[model samples]
Target: MADTHENAYDEFAEAYAAMNETGSWNAHYERPATLALAGEVAGLRVLDAGCGPGILTQELTRRGATVTGVDASEQMLGLARRRLGGSATFARADLGKPLPFADASFDLVTASLVMHYIEDWSVPLGEFRRVLTRDGRLVFSTHHPTMDFHISGADDYFATYQFDDEWFHGDIVMKMRFWHRPLRAMTRALGEAGFGIDVIDEPDPEESVRESEPRAWESLSTKPAFLFFRAFPRYSA
Candidate 1:
């Protein structure tokens, strides 16, 4: 099911990029969190896993990081290379499989707006830990379980369960699998994946977001639309 959704993205990469450039489609929520988690990327070896159109990759490069962006969609990578120029390298790879990089290769790794589609996130989280240098950080964001539940027409936001939803934006249609995990589940997943949580931020909506999409912004400000986390590889003395 996940693979089907991924392949669908590969087919609609162009349309996706076009819509995303406007900062609509939850861009205001995602971009700020990426920037906050990836502070001072200068001189860092960074990996942008599941990089959609390479916008975040370009941002990391602009901050002086040596960034490598990877995605399963060839079309997306092609668009990334075009927009990013030669500033960063872009590769095609699957998120469900072991990352193609060697152990201890990166100082930081990030995957923005990419986890909800994954059924078993622990696999890639463990793989990410394996590729990080000791003390390297992994920062990623995902749709808030509460937000997912609300958007999916679920009546109860406090329900402790998974909910399935389908999103349709014009011609692009895909199914989403959401895990409505409480904070405990998130921390436990990080611990089991050999990472220690450093920070978990649920930011308020910016003014622009508030003005542009008042209802969404208001809802998100009160209840987070997304969750961002910074985690570091666990060290044993």
Candidate 2:
């Protein structure tokens, strides 16, 4: 990752977690859409990579998956531990480096809104492939290039680079950095990392959001706010 901020969420763990719990984009949109692609996680061993505050971990476990959450922020891990207790395992690990797991350790791996933080996908994608069983699928969600490019006001759509933004969680303001690359680059990175794309989705927000947050529902349903993918290893080792 070029603009490395390993503990980016550490300082705002509490505020972020609180916001994530019921945030229109997260709780109602991204999480639901991502989990739908995950399909039947029941009775499966899953890795929730970059699992902040165990939000998705809790949902995965609730759906009968044995979940292990990993993140670079110790503070976020603390919140995850407190939230899930013995329901899921957690460790402090950076996605830019090797993951601490044995080969073929999981049946599924999810990296929700996490990959954009790392400029390079090779290391983490390889690690995810390494840890997944032969039949395992990697399902993830990330910022849509269209959205990023629009927000960044970058001249070249094909260029891969980093950008900065600010997030507001209640009264707390968090400055964040993220990577932006064209759609082709994302797929290329997956192919080079030994994954074969099975599904590429631009999802609509769940119906529930229509009543609660009509504006977000309308915007998310019509626009490309995020991109989702479900891929499996191309050649099993």
Candidate 3:
């Protein structure tokens, strides 16, 4: 499944970034959430898992972290390398497989807008816990289930609930997954993966973005844009 998505991303690399730049897709969707969870990256050894095009990776570097970015798409990594220059390290990796790094290797791990594409979050979550230092943190953001309910297919928000049980975004040609689980499911998964939940935020879309973008405000304020979380590797029994 990850490979299928990687192949799709390889084909969409140019268009993906262009769409993001032109607002065909919302670039800011995950930015504020990721930054809020990261706090300060200064001097940290950061692992940017599923770092498509390195947008957040570059941001991490700017904040003084020594960052290494990994993604499945060679084309995406190519773009990341070009944009990031010598500022960070880049690697080609598939998230479905074991991450190719030693245990207790990183100060922090970040996965932004990437978890949804994965079928089993536990596999990589466990791997992330394994690679992180005892005190290290993992932060990530994913689609909100309610938002998924609202946007499934109906043009009107009120009309969408009839189609609730279906995989709302399943038919989306682009490779994506939607986890509409309640908060308890997420906390349980993290606990099963050896992580302790530190923070879970459902940010109000209006407040998250700069106030000048009225269109962004209107569209997002009506719905939750994302669910972000910060988790730490459990230190003791």
Clashing pairs for model 3 are none
78-119 per-residue lDDT for model 3 (tens digits): 999998998999999888789889999999999987775565
Off by over 4 Å in 2: 1-6
Candidate with better lDDT, 2 vs 3? 2
Clashing pairs in 1: none
Model 1 agreement with the true structure over 105-209: per-residue lDDT tens digits: 999999988776665668889889999999799999888776777767777665455666666667777554566655566678799998989899887756787
Give, for candidate 3, the lowest lDDT window spanning 10 residues. Answer: 160-169
Off by over 4 Å in 1: 1-6, 24-26, 153-182
Candidate 1 overall lDDT versus native: 0.80
Report lDDT (CA) for all predictions.
Answer: 0.80, 0.91, 0.75
How much is 90 displaced in model 3, in angstroms?
1.2
Better of 1 and 2 by lDDT: 2
Rate residue 98 of model 1 by lDDT.
85
